[model samples]
Target: MTRPSDHDHAPAPAALSADGGRADPAAPPGAPPGHPRRWAGLAVLSASLLLIVMDITILNVALPALSADLRPDSVQLLWIVDVYSLVVSGLLVTVAALGDRFGRRLMLVAGFAVFGVASAAVLLADGPGDVIAVRALLGVGGAMIMPSTLSMIRHLFTDPRERATALGVWAATAAVGSAIGPIVGGALLEHFSWQSAFLVNVPVMVVAIAAGLWLLPESRAARPGRWDAVGTVLSIAGMVALVYAIKHFGKEGFDDPGALVAALVAAVALPAFVVWCLRIPHPILEIRLFRRRAFSAGAVAALCTSLAVAAVLLLLAQWMQLVEGYGPLEAGVRLLPAAVGAVIASPAAPALAARIGARAVLSGGLVVSAAGYLVIAFGPRPLSYATVAVALLLVGAGMGSLAIASAVIMVGAPPEKSGSAAAVDETSYELGAALGVAVLGSVAAAAYRGDLPASWLAERGVTGATAAEARESIGNAMEIAAHAGTAGAELAARAQAAFTTSLEGASLAGGVLLLVAGVLVWVLAPRDLDVSGSSHH
Candidate 1:
């Protein structure tokens, strides 16, 4: 669905080797091969990635205040949070295709402008509807910005070794942004207002826009063929339905009929989209990449790890804020260990892979992640911060494995196909985040209800509807506790205890999943897989 353009500001194509295959796009005519400015371009792309990741986590701490200020009902509140992700996840493939057809830098620059405007528009938002609309706008911008980051990296660092290193740094920055989201949000909320979270993006996006203009070069797919309009529509429909299905399952659990119907829709639409992609000459996603065992193994590894950690990180924030009675800032600061682990491990992933091989490194990382989950699950009562910190360290450190996974994904494809490859990688990540929150979060929520002591509530003289309310969520129990007398205090205590038990059970379940994925990666990822060699005929 791209409109052909006469604008020809795009950078000249890099020269190919005599083999007539894809060559290093880093080199332009009359300029030495692999220009040093490419590194600076990498910096710009990484900055964009950091900003988006931070924005996602930053909202978590601001949601309550936003709700209070806007006075949104439950459905509106959900939309305020859910709409952005739905929009981003649904349109990623389409936008990435646009980037390929038109220009990567063009799409990226437009995204920055759009993101900056949407974020600043929040300053004028006086109601839930306004905020939701702005959030949806930001999602379109985010969808455009995200895929360009990886694909640009793929183009900028044509040397396999340099690309691997760049990817590692990019991965670390991404993890850091996610870990620091609460801290940034808490810091802003403490000094400013809820709108500050959205406003903060304005300045960052401004800087990104300026830097991108100077540093980034325009690139596009050399043979981006006819736009698959029907495929694009199907992808959007399927992904949106899929995200909704996951959200519904997370909120209402498996018994909800709405979730069931949404799942049915997703089941039909997604597979149809996949079949369409396979039959087409030009697809938004290169599903054929999964035919490579190394690529498939790495993809599965990334998805599994993301599924486990996404939920744990989410619940950990709440555990710190509500259960442990820490302020948002303190909770965010305490979570720094996870960032530290990522910083250490991500940069080391390439070296580890070089030494031990992709299969071993990927599998080892998964095993370490599973251990971290187990540690958190089995931690002592009162949820010791020290124990959780260690688990966070392990979790973050283990994500270094994704560096290798990412390399496999990118290297498996030729330079011309990087956009589709990047889209596929991002899609796996988005799906992982969705599934993690949906399935693992649902397990924790179910366990929370199961562990809620109905008998204990009765003994405290809080039964029936009140008891059910207490079991609904920690926030509800806290609201009840604030208004109720001594019985309310007892109810809140029981509810917190139940949530803790539930979290532990969920962590145990995630740990088992990682362990199984680790085994699969070990078996399926070829031991001799090398990123540098994948592009050669």
Candidate 2:
């Protein structure tokens, strides 16, 4: 990571109470931006973020076509799906460190070049291995590009308030990318080959490169010491293992030997890496940043917000498609309310943070988001689109608190250390998303199984083994029902009812979890905290 200059020391704990946060609490709202070119730079940054975020989901819709063309085995297909994230998660801290030591602009441009070239190469992929290789390359490009954009934003907007506002716009990109990826992928696949999915990134990367070169400024740590190569390796291994375990746990549960092994390695390696960072003179990242209330509070807010969004969004998507019988495209379109809410809330947050303080905004937003979940939980049976739309909007608005989360992270650290801070913030987001699926999904599954009629089904041929298999998932349950003849229809109808009830319980639990998180943040964050300027008190 970026080496700290003498002046780049961590903000003193004592000075924090009086010196840091807000330009001035008594002052009126909204400060001007840090630089004349910062907005233009933000456009470039947003595009980069959009591409990286979109890549994560765009592949989901194209998977069937990808399988048809490449004819990947099931195992190969799983690898193809898992490898990109594993590679990206592995390389994040390493790339962020390189971005700080080497110029962030240089690394970003290089990332764009790699991404463009790798995307274009997909046209030549005739087999699963070829596509897997391309995905790995794209992951490297993503790791390089993602942190560069965030750190660059830290440099681009020096004023804490302006930076917070800029970050809000940046945070909205996540919502927008999720909302758009399916639509864009669907449109592309309708008229072109599946390769078009990858090929599309080429032109966008080109535009991003040209704009980045023109609009972005170069930045790096001023006095970076000897690079910690060992720490880099440890971080890569630890994160890769952690993410693999998380993804595996979400899909196959915790019993798999591979997942257990990965989780063990991650649990061991991560703490060792932390200890390594603490002992070293010029560490990979300042792990101590977590000690600060603003930083920790914001990180918690970001994580919990992501957990709520990811888990609820999964259930909501299934409800809209499977339960409500909407087409895939229609369900995706209906979910756009969340994106719209985020777009509005993101840019508006800095002013709000300026007025009531970021602590309140962060905590308050989570509570509001929880209210949305409550609406989902207790709304009239057979879900209503109007009610869901309103709920999605609230969820999105609450997630807009991520703007404050980003600010607390970046503002709490020195500009030169932006890469490390960005990596931490980004990791929190990814981990939260994964955990949300694993935890809430497991909860929902239990509720579904519990609500199912057990003894009645056992008397039929659908006893023991068959019933056990059906209870595995809603999709499996429906599939089993479809071929079970007359008796199965009743089972299928009941399964649907049970699944819907599970969603209610899951939504309620998720809402309560978010409320608890909001309370924790309310206690952890300070009331007078300000990010109006540099917070290195």
The number of the candidate with the highest TM-score is 1
Best by lDDT: 1
The TM-score of candidate 2 is 0.76
Model 1 misplaced regions, further than 4 Å: 1-40, 63-86, 121-135, 154-168, 249-255, 414-416, 453-470, 534-537
What would you estimate as the lDDT of candidate 2? 0.71
Off by over 4 Å in 2: 1-42, 57-89, 113-137, 153-175, 186-199, 206-220, 243-256, 414-419, 441-502, 534-537
Model 2 clash pairs are: 21-530, 22-530
Quick one: how many clashes does candidate 1 have? 0
lDDT of predicted model 1: 0.73
lDDT of 1 by residue, 360-405 (tens): 8889999998998999788776678888999988887887555556
How would you encode candidate 2's per-residue C-alpha lDDT over 200-277 as one tens digit per residue? 999999998899999998989787567788887887788667766765664556797898999999999989999999
lDDT, each prediction: 0.73, 0.71
Error at 376, model 2, angstroms? 2.4
TM-scores for candidates 1 onward, in order: 0.85, 0.76
